[model samples]
Target: MTIYGYRIPMMASLIVWCILWEIVGRLDLLLLFPPFSDVLVALGDVVNSRSFASAVSITLYSYAWGLGLAIVFGVALGFLMGTVPVADRLLNMWVNVFLSAPLSALVPVIMILFGMGAPTVIVTVFMFAVWIIALDTRAGVLHVPASLLEMARSFGASRWTTTWKIVLWAAMPEILAGIRLGVIRGVKGVVIGQLLVSIIGVGALFTTYSNNFLMEHFWALTLILFAFALTVGQLIALLEARIDYYAGARS
Candidate 1:
């Protein structure tokens, strides 16, 4: 980023924040804000624990299932909505409502339906993620050029072939972008679900640490979750970049 006519690297900015955090922590400005060094040490301790491993495994399992289902159903529904006027009219209002709604309020309803189980968490993640993906994918489809469709038709391409090659490729960049955003939301959803419905996985650790006022451990776990989300989001962003290239090529 540029500041005072000088460009600063992102990592440099991060380091500055870390140093500031350390200073504030060491000064005891806030009891909740412990030293970064202590948090790092706690991170090492937490990572080596059996509880951490188990929690991670459960969280990952729920995340994978939720994200996978979200992508599959979201893309299919979005594709249909974009291509079919009737479907779009029928579903658009509901999609917009859900997107704008405070989904946290729905957690209790979800828990009621699915009970205190991994299924509830998976569904929560899916709920948080799917609407945005569907919306973005629909937008991608809507933006697909009419000329491309006509050209495919003129070339004797079947509807299926045109959709598969032309429509999908044209839409891929936005779809991937949506997926990246959805993944981040999905992470939040997983945590909320676990914390609210059942204290399992990383949620369990968060409960234990916060209840015991283990600030170092609490911050360490928070940092781990943040890192995991950032890493996954970065990977998805790279994929989006690659798909953007293809979209440009198609254009």
Candidate 2:
């Protein structure tokens, strides 16, 4: 970032926000916010607790399963929609609707179908993530050069070989971009699912903290989730950068 003709590090903005938060918290301007330093201390304490370990394990388990399923099905659906006009015509409207819909309202329906506990949470994450991934993948596949497909076929490449080796590879950048977005959405899904379904995992801790008015601990937990989401996004963005040549190649 630039300020007064001087470039500032990206992290400077975060530090500034933290300072402001600290000042406001110290002044008791907001009942919900505790001093940032206290939150940091709470962070250390929370991390060292056994309950935190269990919560992390449960959250990660549900998240991994849901995201894995979303990736598998989302990519497959997208590939179908991209290649087959019939499938596109049939599914595209629903995909767009789900993408724009208020998804949280659908969680209760999922809970009814999947029942309580981790299953519901897993489904929630899948529901939250899959649509965007499918949409992006379809867009990527659609953008693949027709010339590439013709060349592959002329060279006697089998259908599977053409799709797996050429089409998917060409579409890697957008697929990864979709997956990155899906990861962020999946985090929200897992949190909300746990909170609404059965209050297991980090949701349980959140319940305890909020109900007890442990603002510092609550904020610390929130920061951990924010950090996780940002870290995953950066990692995927790095992967996208590495394969950006595919986008250039497409052009």
Candidate 3:
């Protein structure tokens, strides 16, 4: 970030927000926002509680299953669409529709099919994340150089070998980008799924806190979710940086 021709670290912006939040909280400017310090204290309490531990375990379980399925199916679908024009023509419109649609509205349909349980939440995450991943992967695969494909063919590489070695490697930067985005969307899916389909895990905690007007605890929990999403994003971004040479090679 920059101001007045001087660059500022990104963290500085977050610090400024915190300072503002603290000031507003101290002044009791909003009933929803308690003092930042109090929320920080509540954060510790929330983390150490047994309920938090259980919630974390359940949430992680659902998240993992959902994201795993999304990756597998999404990558496969993307590969198909990218490699086969027929598949692309058949699926492209629906994929774009789902990607642009209000996915939250589909949660109730999922719940009806899967019932009010963890399965619904898992399916919700998968639905929320898979389309974007497939779209990005298709884009990446489509961008793989024709020269690379020809080289693989000249080397007498089998179809699977060519795709696995040349195409996938070249397309990896965008693939990872898609996965990173999918991860963030999956978090939202998990939260919404749990809240609506089954109030267990962190959703339950959110309910407990909000229903009782535990604003500090509510904000603390919100911060934790934000931190988790940001931390995952940063980790994937680092991985993207490491593999960025692939993009440069493509160009």
Candidate 4:
């Protein structure tokens, strides 16, 4: 009755790891690393703190908005580059330049320009993450098999029709992979932006705790961020798995 067979084992492994981590942390051989129970208590405290809730909400909001804008423009630009040589030529240099540059260093510049807060941080994250999505999508489109295109065209498929029907379907696996990578990088960029450009988020809290040598708080916040990233990554994997199953099995 199962549509796919992989989910149960993966979920079991995740649960096992969490249990093991809690047990190990509770043993507490390391003075600096607090028990998982303590971390949970801290999480509860942070969750109940209005200031922490507000900061977390702002961070999440900025992350969603920035990532959304990136996807919109990135996908559009990617499609344009795939279809138009001039678009690729005009964009290639700048794209590479931005990608190659140390964008984390320019957080101060972003702060100066945008004058602090979520606006600057979100922009910095988008700047760091968008190029990967655009470039990968463009490459995926270009590398699609010519035979597929010809077949679609032979059926008198219009330009738009071919793009949507054949090109997009073929490129989806790769495009989704790019999105997965971009999302992870975007999360990291958000943390970096929060630390450097603003004084908020788990990143900022982690910095403050570490600077004050509050190892328990530092590690607790870090664990939360790690869990967040892992959750996002797993969601992306689930999406990709679903896409592959639908596209591959529907002969």
lDDT of 2 by residue, 135-246 (tens): 9999999999999999999999999999999999999998999999999999999999998886999999999999999999999999999999999989999999999999
Q: After superposition, how far is residue 146 of candidate 3 from its true place, in Å?
A: 0.4
Per-residue lDDT of model 4, residues 162-212, tens digit only:
998888877776677777777888888888888877877756676777788
Q: Put down candidate 3 lDDT per residue, 91-157, tens digits, no spaces.
A: 9999999999999999999999999989999999999899999999999999999999999999999
Instruction: Give the winner by lDDT.
Output: 2
| Cα displacement (Å) at residue 12, model 2 | 1.2
TM-score for candidate 3, please give it: 0.97
Alpha-carbon deviation at 184 in model 2, angstroms: 0.3
Question: Any residue pairs clashing in model 3, and if so which?
Answer: none
Q: Which residue runs does candidate 1 get wrong by more than 4 Å? A: 3-6, 249-251
> Lowest-lDDT window of 10 residues in candidate 1?
242-251
For every model in order, what is the number of clashing pairs? 0, 0, 0, 0
The TM-score values for the models, in the order shown, are 0.95, 0.98, 0.97, 0.79
lDDT of 4 at 81: 88
* RMSD versus native structure for model 2: 1.0
